[model samples]
Target: MRVSVVIAAYNAQGYIAEAIESVLGQTVPPDEVIVIDDGSTDGTRSVLERFAGRIVALTQGNSGQAVAVNQGLALARGELIGFCDADDLWTARKQELQLARLERDGELDAVFGKVQQFVSPDVPEQQRARLTPAVEIMPGELKQCMLIRRDALMRIGAFDETLPATFFIAWLGRAKQGGLKTAHVDDIVVRRRLHPGNGGRLHTEAQNLQTLMALRKAIKAQRPPE
Candidate 1:
């Protein structure tokens, strides 16, 4: 498998179909698409079952997204790892373009593209350009928009299972400290849903603070004062 797409799903029945369809529609279909069901009480299981054989479904106790992601990472057999939130949708060409870019630049450890946010599902075609502006990315930008090398993930330690909500922040800081080569792609590859029901956005203030603090600790551990 060249690429593994991991998604942590919890009560995502409302949006799981779109997420799955987005992956299925990718220009470069992933070698394996794994959906970790973190004990969703909703109809998420049934929805996932509909895609059996099409996707690898792993279910476990309610361990939260971080743990689920780690499990998926461990199970992934791809050289590259792509992450997608169960609520987000990817552009059809996202994986294909990113894989080609990565192959062309073999030195890079990872790459992140642009992301757009929408409150309502009916975003206008022309107005969609209001999303994130094209900008050069530093490793500190954000992990959600990036595709990480599987080996890099193991070296940095997949999502920190200890801190459920702030794992990505810590992981990104560690990657930067370890001198991973990274780049940014200007094209919009995914759409971030902004509904209040979404856990990440709804708890952004708290999670952001926690993530920042965790990142600081990780950075200090990686680079002690000279």
Candidate 2:
């Protein structure tokens, strides 16, 4: 199956190249790579230009991740779709392994693998010393770790553009409620870079509230009519 990889970037000049490089270097390269630049004021656009012909680079007004992702989804032309955060790296065998598992099981709508977290090597020694992730590696059910069929994704529908911090969480909740079949592998597929500018770290309060709201919405969707 043709696989399309999507990346949503905003002010990721420092690490976006590495993220794209990792995907390009995968053992089984994606059929297409789509990157949506969310109106970054930094050198992110310049960095994207470096990979001009290799990627389908799109620029848009300062929209949030959800909007950028939705835009990519609309333009994607693949049977299977995957995502990689602008600051994260995919292992060289990520696509190869995940695609194998997906093709082996016709009933599985999606497949995910483990994720390894690490501080960016570019972080200063003092800054790295101050930051520590609770878990180095764990089973990742996040978008970055998933390889899903396009039809399945369409059934779940577009992500909620309103929930900036928790859109994926809300979408995942809805997918589960819709009985999306999924599977997990033991191998590490993604390396999540933890940095000072991480959205979750920078917007803790908003994320917390949004997480609660996503859960409530999921519960309400499952209830009978009043």
By summed lDDT, the worst window of 10 consecutive residues in model 1 runs over: 131-140
Badly placed stretches (over 4 Å) of model 1 are 122-144, 223-226
Model 2, 181: alpha-carbon shift in Å? 0.5
CA RMSD, predictions in order: 4.4, 0.8
Q: In model 2, what is the error at residue 183, expressed in angstroms?
A: 0.6
lDDT string, candidate 2, 78-122, tens digits: 999999999999999999999999999999999999999999888
Deviation in Å, model 1, residue 187 alpha carbon = 0.2
On the 0 to 100 scale, the lDDT of residue 108 in model 1 is 82
Superposition error at 218 for model 1 (Å)? 2.3
Question: Global lDDT for candidate 1?
Answer: 0.80
- Most accurate candidate by TM-score: 2
Overall local distance difference test of candidate 2: 0.96
Q: Tens-digit lDDT track for model 1 on 54-157?
A: 99998999998899998998899999999888988888888877787888988988888888766545545554454333542232244556777888778877
